[model samples]
Target: MGTTTNIIRVLFISILIDFLEFTIILPLLPKILTYYGRDTGINQDSLYVQTMSFVQFIQNLTGAPNDAKWNSVLFGGIIGSLFSFLQFFSSTLCGAASDRYGRKPMLLLSMIGISVSYGIWCVSFNLTIFMLARVIGGLSKANVAIILAIVSDSTTENERNRAMAWIGAAFSLGFIFGPLLGAFCSQWGIAYWPNSTMMFFIVPAVISLVLSLINIVFIIQCCPETLPIAKRDSKQTTITDISNKILPWHLFKFTAIHNVKSVDDIIILRRLGLASFLYMIIFAGLEFTITFLVYNRFNWNSMKQGKMFFIMGLCMALVQGGYVRRIPPGKEIIAAISSNIISHTNQDL
Candidate 1:
């Protein structure tokens, strides 16, 4: 039990650091896009310029707004979508690999990948390199899911919920603090090194890299192999099996589950999957674009953006910690419906 408790604590810290690195860039996305867009030193034939031209061409073709602010938003959106797309595929691969290998090895690999990504970001001089950093970060972001798996492996069924709640709290705290820290670092960098664009971004990247390196060391020294050899899935997962998992199927017709024979069960599963999928789409869309929206609409800088996210994260943590957990078990569907209705109504307003 003491070992289990220690493992959970380490995993919690790992997740908190990962999310801090993840959300640190949220308030800076718009600024990042704008910086690359307006920088005149970039060669016209370079990847950054070519990519921006392609994005602008697509915007023109699609009749997207043709202004600097809108262009920044569009570029940020494209980058954000690419990151998410890569994550979607990499997450499935990582999960399968963990099942085959031990959890610690896969987790270490993920952390190393993330650390390398941040290292690249620290030296990213142009948009192309920055995009590459994002790609690597996305591909390495299986830590959260793997952390949950570790929690499951280390905890008894009766203790799982409490452990999961602690993980959730780590996420909430990360969201609450990460952006503010990033904002402070960014502002400090800009103030101290006013003439250096690289310093503005490098400061936050360096901090993230340090945290990742600490996580990697901690895992190597302390984390144990949760999946014992006797309990391991020895069946070699083939390419086709991995492909099936990675491919995105229609939400209304989920084809992943092989054992459910009842039509009613299938229908219920599909409905639930569709609901979750749509909810994520909407939530993620807003979350990504909110930075750009505020930047464009209110002319807010990083500090203001950080404060906005702080408030948002605080509210989310409060609701989840205070209200959501207390809802009666059978009333989950009703609660979900009510929350969705309220969320959508707020959006409309």
Candidate 2:
């Protein structure tokens, strides 16, 4: 529970690795779309067809003439939305599973799943396979929530903000290095392996796979289970139970059922939840669209885009690590900021 323990450091490192793996693909997405769009011949069975159909629908909706230039942007946005949407669906289930099982087991499982997803991505040959890889990655990722839970389990109310600030800094560090690494590998792939199909994506995917494997090993060796035996859930929750719990009607059922300490407290919580929801929507839109904006406007390749993201990451790290330390924000303000950070940081690339 102490900040000095190996657990916090390991968790921090693990979360950093996770973010690196997640964001490494951001710069490579345009290449992915190009690959699929070029190669998707007469195969109606491909996911590319469905994606194009959806793209066409959007094009029609806006009364805009069809343009090949916008294909990557539209495709990337849809793919990114799919990934985040799946995360939204599965997060509650994963969080509950972590509670019922142990955090260590759940974290290890999630990381391993992510590793496999990256491995699959490295070898993916088609649009369908690549999108499937994204699906697997999205469904497997609930580590951020669990990692934060681990932070909360260990820190006191007064110390929690500072502890979380470090985690936020780690998140920023990941964003800083992840895209840079992607750019390096991408350039390497283009320079040395020009003949290979999907080299642009393969290079970054391989890097992500390697980092994920290392993270998995670190978690197994260093991350001790934080939930005590007495506090662990005894109920053997099956898939059905989890499915039922995550049903739409059940989302706010707990709040409805629980006894409130005060009407004002309930009102405050509802406001926080609403604020968090709106913040996530806006931040996620920005995060997903940034790659498209840079690629189209500045004609930036993966490496140049990575440099831009590196600057953003540097700014984030400076604010979180330096500014927050000098003047710690209040809990409510931190909570709102945390919501924004979680949405932006935890988004799947």
Error of 2 at 218 (Å): 0.2
lDDT of 1 by residue, 1-349 (tens): 8998898898778778777877888888888776666656745327667777877998989998888777777777778888888887777778767877978888888889999999999988777788889999999988877788899899996677667767877787788888888888899999999998767678988988998898899888988899987877797777667666776673246565566769888898888978888888888888788899999989999889989888887877776656765666567689889977876785641
Clashing pairs in 1: none
Report per-prediction Cα RMSD to one decimal: 2.5, 4.3
Alpha-carbon TM-score of each model against the true structure: 0.90, 0.88
Write down the worst ten-residue block by lDDT for model 1. 36-45
* Cα lDDT computed for each candidate against the true fold: 0.81, 0.79
Candidate 1 segments whose C-alpha is farther than 4 A from its true place: 1-5, 41-45, 156-158, 250-268
- CA displacement after TM-score superposition, residue 259 of candidate 2 (Å): 8.6
